[model samples]
Target: MDASVRLHLLKSCISYATHDHVRKSGHRASMPPKALLLTSQPSLRNVVSRAWRAATSITPYQTSCFKPNKNWTLRSIDHGARPYSAKTKPTVSAVLKNIKDHTAENIVSIFHSRSNNPYHNLAIENYLLRNSHAQSKILLFYTNRPCVVIGRNQNPWLECNIAKIQEGLPWNAADWDDGVLDNDRHVIAEERDGYNVSLDLVRRRSGGGTVIHDVGNLNFSFIVPNDKDFTRDKHAELIVRALMAPMTVTRFRDHVLYDNVHVNQRHDIVMTCANVDGGNTQKEFKVSGSAFKLTRGRALHHGTILHSSPNINRQVFVAGDEGGQVAASVFSALLSSPAKPFLEAKGVGSVRSPVHNLFDVTDQVQRREVVRSLRKEIGQLFMDVNGMGDISVEEVGDEDCAVDMNGEIYRDAQELMTDDWRFCQTPTFEYRSEDAGGALKMRFQVKHGLIQNASLEHVELDAEQQLKFAGLEGKKLHEIQSWTSCLPPHAGFRHAKACAHLETVFPKIQPAGAAREGGAESTIIQEADLSGSNQDGIAVKRKAPGGRIELERGGENVVVER
Candidate 1:
């Protein structure tokens, strides 16, 4: 049988078993309780009510939210007489407290965000990582303001709109200093002070396409033992079910169903980010997405959820998107949904899917409620995972996580999120030059800190000029135009135009004196060096600058051999 069909059958079987268990119980009450009626399915509520009315005419049935017993089993009238107390409540910290060991492989804990600022939360994760053992598993959920987060290996100049930020602020022209950038997160704070602006730009150690963080959005990270967790369909399915839970669906009005949102099960791979689909194209609507980072033998899987709201709309549609088509379709889905506060879309292709925030689509739900529902679902999933059946779990309210606003963690996080580390550290990339002619568009590509390719749209290169241009391929971007000694006159203007575009993309860039043969030591390893014998190098030649250098320059031919 198909996996989807099997999962459906499993759900049906569980529902049937729950209904049977509820019906056979000998517990009796003066009125039919709310929890009992819901177990039979929403459509059968009328039949259940009529049967109750016929059997017991003394008192009317009173319904309330369902709560599982201490043993994690469904409750009947007898046990439903009283609700569970605060002791059984579950929060990320509280669930963790119940565990006897933190480093146990199966142990899972949910941690609430300490602050709305993205820096503090990540900093806390860093602090915890410093003290954690390899076997520990942790999950963090946060909601941040409008900001851009880059992948560990990405070129920030190409990934972010740095040119528009304060009219293309200039960064340090020389190569980034490792003594200053020394694996420290504090540089972000220094840049904030230097730039006289809040450090909103950030680069996470994980890999993924650029994403915009906004209000009405939830971010989740699962730090597990290995990459094996990414392949498990069960965990992904649970996350999806919680993301589009009944409560969230109800808030959006009946026009959209749980089917409106979907997930792609691929690790470290990103799908095209379009506006949330409203039942229109066959293109899968990726409402929730994730990226992974395997570090120190542990894996961190993180992603985002687009909850409904104006703040989300403003923050999610950053300048890089295809303008407002995506945002339009999303809001249209919400506004056009049916009166029932649920989603059900039959038509695909040209028939757009309904996508709306809960507030715009329905009158009954709130942001807090939707978050609560997700937390509850996740808590229950934990119980099932640990084989702790029928356990009591409540969505606890917020509390201070003991992180001082002016403390070390906060300061470190604040500094590590600055523009220098976020923008200047990006791998070299080309950009459009504003000073160039109206129709003169130029493009360039750089790799390993060297300009690999350069092009002038309508301009072609002659013999000597073409060879010079090709020779300039492996040179540093800033140094490409400065090689005036060897290049023929034709390559000068072309080189200058290319550099102009490069600086426009990377504002702070300046023409460094010469191209150093020994590359600077990288703070973050982009890719693991696996080219040696049996994936183990006899000697990793990739090392930081510590040796004396010898310069061999005979006329125009100059090389800084280290």
Candidate 2:
């Protein structure tokens, strides 16, 4: 017979057996054998199956719903009742007094919530919150269906796709049931009627090492080993690790259900970040109570979990490379250490510095001042990286380079050549020049830092002239120019090369021996020469006959015989 026919026959036989028992117990059975039994013909089988189901209210054992025990008499109830005082109650006061009594005999019977399954991590957390005095908790979770949970230190969206869930193909879903069906016992109880159920602690972690096993039909429970249980830290770490773990996509073929009832997608890998900074920092911890954002947006509220270290800032971010978050946290903790009274004298508040220390400080106050200054500087330092066209590197003499107020070298000044250069609020490079009198002058600017900015002390095969005539070749230079042009005419930084070139080419035309001279580093373009003469040596002179005369050498009409 086919599977469906066999199923119908087995259901009929079970119904017959139930009715037989009712008849023997002197109760009139509603179901008849002819109606309960299936026939060889498909149509007859269906008609009989329907008639039997309609006649008898006997639900199969498999689909039995839980109902409260209402038929028990007072005598039967009394037999099950036990005195609360006589029964061993793990009291809050008793657990506290026995925490330090680790002689293996003091808190011998005091096991917290006797459960051992690692999947109970979430339940353990809830247990801890409810009984404030409960020493600790163990979580136990069991399922024929497989699943993968995220880490405590990770951004979920970057780790997994939410749009997929909205698309109905939730990265995690099942075939037998909708992916969002409630798996909670209370929810299940409310949905299914008529059930009396009791939960008892089944699995446990005692004096032995971690054990993994299936203890048939028993409800998994948690156990707090002793007063000096390390589960608290371990559980916290596990939670952090889970939350911070990276998100991943996978198929359910691996951890398949045995009965195939709760068929689901099972991911083998735990998607959590391994790095210490994989989670959130102190600043991000209190934002929205979320470990990460769903999308990249300016969220008014967001949150993260940080590794709280007493030695460092307890609230450091855990989402950057280099583990800088943890390191900065450590430094912050030391700054606010009670043993260090000297830091307090400097008038710096105890708030931990969020970013790495970028400035040198002699004391706590100086450190905080440096941090404050750094914060203020960062606010002003807004660079629209997208607005930047192209990037090129140039080495101005080592002396030409100077750290900005924020201490970052704005080496690529040419990037600022775009018209919106004013958008680059960060001080990148500072320019310094000397006059013939030895007085030094300075101007602040940024560079896409092209080779043209470098100074040549002497001519080598006349490379300077070749380069000047060659003009800028890099695509980056052109891009910067293009971007700069898009801004207002005067918005961006002017290349110093323009002014320096004018200075160098100007002095060579001075009358012999009349050239302005001084510091070799300074060009001889004095004030008077700048206001006169074109490069063709056309000297503008006042004529003896009242009008100004433009004079040039080799002119045929020049007949003045002085």
Candidate 3:
């Protein structure tokens, strides 16, 4: 028989078989039977099999009779011929089980996040804290892109220069026109260019002073049982030991470089050096800051290590010897708001201190070597404390794993990224602003991130202007994209200047529409659905800007326009 005629007969046979099976079982058939008839008649089976192969060779079969069923199972046909099975998503219980398995058998479990997303890394830390084995100790290492992370109870306005952070650090030619000079009056090789990376503002769950994280910095977290042995300074001391330990690198083999580094009263790691003239005078600069969180039965301690962050204010530097030039100050101080003197916040305030990078202490040390040294020293300490054998490090946060373990991690990350968590959680504060001559003064009382009261001090206004000013009472501090929008039309120059000052103090919050339309950071979270598969089968495609196609789903408003 001709090939086309054979394929037509095969199709007819498949349709009939599917209709018969559905009529008998009242459900869709997984696969039409080529076995039952083929076993009885071998010649007919061979002909049908040849026809099926010929049809599939041209293009995939897309017949109306072959509908997919969720409950379908793959089974072998005649002569041990098995059909392909589609990939299935991992269940929530299965993901949880995998985590439990990793922690249950191992006394010391180490994880290194491959994700640069701060929210995702933090969420993974939280997940490990809540779900890991109670008796097992967990260590996680992660690095975030350029971002300013404030404590849970801290105020963003007082801790950071919101305008600078939102706008990012742009290169200034004038500042770098002249080469950077060290204490010796010699030019240094430090890059004159400024960092142009996008900065994200985050409010973490742990309570501590605000800190900045970038690619050059490494964050280490410890999740251990909250027992009598657990102290806030334990992990910090371990970190200090790691810094003071001799490097594995050949050039620095016999040298213990960070001997001056020690943990301070506040659990922060600092480096203290004596004056070059052999005097008693000592200079100290913080190299790491620690933060802690205690749950019912578990305790979490996480801290940042400044390796070689280039985001530093070149104006500030520690004096070194005649041949030594040290760049130890971070640009965080420069990015902090100058309005701290005027704003009286209710939450915990950061203790201002001079910071230095580990690289400055020894130019021979690299970020990878720092991480390796820290990991080795910390792992040794953990093993000594727990009397455990050697342990291996596990990596997480890959695309497939992130999709599989998206239940709690996704929710926690989404919550942390929201404006409600970032800004609305701020404590009540009072902002006072005035001109240089004190002729114009404005005071705002903000509670729970909303403006509760507004009064223009030492200024007169009409009834309409007063009403317009009153309109600011219920407005949210973060939602206000522009301070001018809240002011009355043709407001006086003084009022405009005061509003402009307020605008500079407050960070710009991205609108909900912008988030839905795919804004920064949020876009990374929204593009991946909860189930990792489209719940709705309907898809709409449209041509977007830059000649890219945007894919939108019907049931879920997922806009994937990468």
Candidate 4:
């Protein structure tokens, strides 16, 4: 045999003999696969021979415990199991008390949310998610209770008006320095342009440190517009259609990329109306042998609802019981309409908005339905902005105005709250070499007069200009650095491609790590599994250049596999 081959054979004989002795002495079942590798590879012959000599030379320690399988596999469960229990409901008083404690710090009033408890929160979130088939109530305004509002397809920071949010952005514009009508004061109305008006101010109600804010009573309404071409029934139809269609929730990104989306699911909502029909039923109740009565409407259950809203022109959103309460409260207070609960619990008192006729309603039927539906419990599914910075519907308690007065205000006052209002999109300012002194280009996203996002674009400056700009001081010119980020204070994020310039300014952000190190020698194995495909006693695989081992198990051969 060749000298190298002879050395490997000698090492293998020693390992086999030692392992046999261990098995006979009840210390182990078999030799480790690593021992076999050391015996087989010519490059490891010397090391293996030395190890064998040490094993033969060493005296045994009487108290030492032998671990039979040093390379044992660790297994774990994918999903944890939870015990099941009968579904329970939260008491109205407890829910109210929670909201009251949460929103207590705010000045002006109006609150809305799905629920507070994780169970109710999850249940309500799921319920609305499941029922987003209808284009129902989007402005889930509450008159006297409190709730949290998460953004739609927006990072809460990007969608929310931060300054106003921090300063207790009132749902009503009255509290805002902005000249627009307040959410709590003026009834949301539409303008001739058809776009819902929005205040320059950012209003937010954070979930943290949240407490209850008393919304006098609850009022709910599906603000469906009745234009000349759209009737109340048509508006209701649009809401139903929108609700029936599958609703979607998604993530916001500066650049669109798949997998950037974290959550995508249908809205959970349930519809029950004495007048609607057609849908599969999970359980049915009968009045008289053949006559059937509708009790509950669900997606997986029976109902005459479609999976998506039919209206392409209308926007749709649904409210849970808590949401419904808040909406009913708002509608009741603004419309002078009494608040009706989801099932019962009538709201006490006359309803009126601080501004009159806020809907900016031009159509008589919609105006009437908007007024009429204020009292009925038929369960509404309709479309309208409810004056989310749009047009005014009506005033609740305007001292000089009639109950139906339509006060126009935005064209005159929207900017009153501007400078302090934190904007969702911080305008990016770019300076060319000429605009800025030399070849250096500057880009930044500003918030509250602070540069939260910054970058410089480098270019070769003429010798004369470079000397002039360079005199201004400490700046690197040749280096081009860039990075992607999701900063605090705002949730909207920009993830730029990695660039050389950014590599210098931000070194640790680089993707290369031990994971990128070359060869298995540089790779660290914390654990491994040996089962099924790894039925073999041992398996060897080549590690990719980056130290990622792609193991292909050859079954039915070895006692254990690693």
lDDT of 2 by residue, 192-296 (tens): 112211111111111111111111111222234334333223222332233222220012122111111110121011122122254342221110011111112
The number of residue pairs in model 1 that clash at the backbone is 31
Give one digit per residue, the lDDT tens place, for model 4 in 1-562. Answer: 1344335335544655465445445432121211222123334544554564455442221111111122221111111111011121211223222322322321111212212111122222222223323322222222221222221111222222222222221232111111111121221111111222122221121111111122211222222112244332332333334323222112112111111111111111223322112444332111000001111231111111111111111222223334352322321221120111101111112111111111223332232233233221112222122222222121121111111121221211222123222222222222122232231343433333233234433424454344233231232221112222221111121113222222222222111011211111323332242123223334423333222233322221111111
TM-score of each: 0.46, 0.19, 0.65, 0.20
> Which residue runs does candidate 1 get wrong by more than 4 Å?
1-106, 163-199, 227-234, 244-260, 265-283, 309-365, 388-415, 428-435, 438-504, 507-562
Question: How does model 3 score by TM-score?
Answer: 0.65
Error of 1 at 537 (Å): 57
Candidate 4 residues lying further than 4 Å off, grouped into runs, are: 1-202, 206-363, 378-419, 424-449, 459-562
Query: Residue 227 in candidate 1 has what lDDT?
Result: 48
Clash count, predicted structure 4: 104
Winning model by TM-score: 3
Q: In candidate 1, what are the lDDT values of residues 212-258, reduced to their tens digit?
A: 45445567766666745544344556576654566545654543423
Q: Least lDDT summed over 10 consecutive residues: which range in candidate 1?
A: 552-561
Candidate 2, 524: how far from true, in Å? 90
Give the winner by TM-score: 3 or 4: 3
